[model samples]
Target: MRFVAKRQKEGVNVSDTHPLVEASTLIVGLAAIFAIIAVALIFVVELALYFVSAEDEANLFGDWLPDDLITVAPNDERLYQTQLLVDRLASHWPGAPYTFRVEIDDSEIANAMALPGGLIIVTQGLLNQVESENELAFVLGHELGHFRNRDHIRALGRGIVLSMFFAVVTGNDAAGIGIKAADITLRGFSRRQETRADEFGLGLVHSEYGHVDESWRLFERWNIDGSSFLDLVTYLSTHPETGDRIADMKRHAELERWPVDGEITDLSW
Candidate 1:
């Protein structure tokens, strides 16, 4: 009877703790549910911010240059030349939604920029510096390569998402986070993306002009002109460093077995 009583007491003790076990299980389940909800909310917020940023960029640039003004030319000859180059390159892509335009900024700063939605602007200074149609094609093709990969959009989206994340965590303003995010996005493109664009651009030049080497030659000329600072700024503000980019281009050229010739298109028209 004593032994039976001890066994019965042990069983009662275990039964008494069952409610605690159930409470613990309930707590864990609630925690898991909360975690999942938090993650889903974060993802939805990130996606929404990304699209918002893209729309904002589109609107900001739209105010300056409306969609109708895309084809407005500062000079007819330059516009015609730009159109020709864009057509040739677009043919290479075979279905890319690319619209090419030359925005003749009289700022005397030799620069070219590729924006989202296939908007490309080549400064008068840059146009005046190039020697041949092929060189121009190479440069324009690089910009087109950016467009095809949607780098601008990706960069903008990334910036927005990251900025929003930062702002949420740090309690900073949206505008402050945005500037930081943009700075981060432009420091370096994803290696895979950059390589893909480089190869695609190189192939376009090769297929069109039979000059696979033109891409590197153009960089070499830019390097010779002591444009490293501008290149650095571009890498920080728009793309990657020129030296690193050239190296990547060279690697791809070797992989594709493209011939190495010092022949460069003269831009001194």
Candidate 2:
């Protein structure tokens, strides 16, 4: 009887958890499992990227990227600015193995990106938004860092893998859907990766311009137009928060005793 009573007590205790508590526990466990999976996948991507050459990654995906940049004339002001930035920013990268290129897309989204094959695309909106060439240098150098670390290629591989997996699971998305998925995925990266790129960019800016001024203005102005909670979250999830970036940048500048304030060179033709 004592043994039976003890067994019953143990079973009762096991079932005593509130329904809500059990539900919460299940949710947390699933979330943890998902987090672990995501981290593992990113680690795998990082390892794969280490072995893949930047040029090869570029060649694999370079042919398919939507080249809206090709529409603008080579001498167009935005295009010219992009070319000059490539020369000013990318030239300083010593023993750089990959060829660097920049193109300007006619858009108001205020964005830029680097493709695997040393292609950098700057939007017209980004050109208009920046207050100075120094700001532009920071932006370009940040993208360049993506190339140096081959993060762009890692992102490219992730997108392709996910899109293919989704297609296999759903068996519904068409080829166009896959293409769009790739574009969307390329737009995001892990926050740690982005911060490293910022460091790379800021270091390059210091090397070239001898100082950084008004770097915060680049992000502040963009957010001023009202970065919504969702947009802010979405952007920050992959890139460090704007305030954090500015704060770190200032700390580095102070440590290096780099120039804090200087003349704002116009970002123009």
User: Which candidate's TM-score is highest?
Assistant: 2
Residue ranges of candidate 1 with Cα displaced over 4 Å: 1-73, 158-182, 190-192, 227-236, 262-269
lDDT of 2 by residue, 88-182 (tens): 77778986757776777766656778776777887776776677888888988989989888877777766665655555537543334443433
Kindly state the number of residue pairs that clash in model 2.
0
| Local distance difference test, candidate 2 | 0.70
Task: Assess every candidate by TM-score.
Answer: 0.61, 0.74
lDDT of 1 by residue, 1-269 (tens): 35443433456545655787887775666545434544454456456546655445445555354344334355567767676777877798875644455465553445666676456777666676666777677777777776776665555555555555555547534334334433443343455566676777787887776667556655567666675456435433454556777888888878887765645555422
**Model 2 — which ten-residue stretch has the worst lDDT?**
173-182
Q: What TM-score does structure 1 among the candidates reach? A: 0.61
Cα misplacement distance, residue 269 of candidate 1 (Å): 4.7
Best by lDDT: 2
Per-model C-alpha lDDT, please? Answer: 0.61, 0.70
Candidate 1 clashing pairs, residues 3+ apart or interchain: 130-267, 131-266, 131-267, 131-268, 132-266
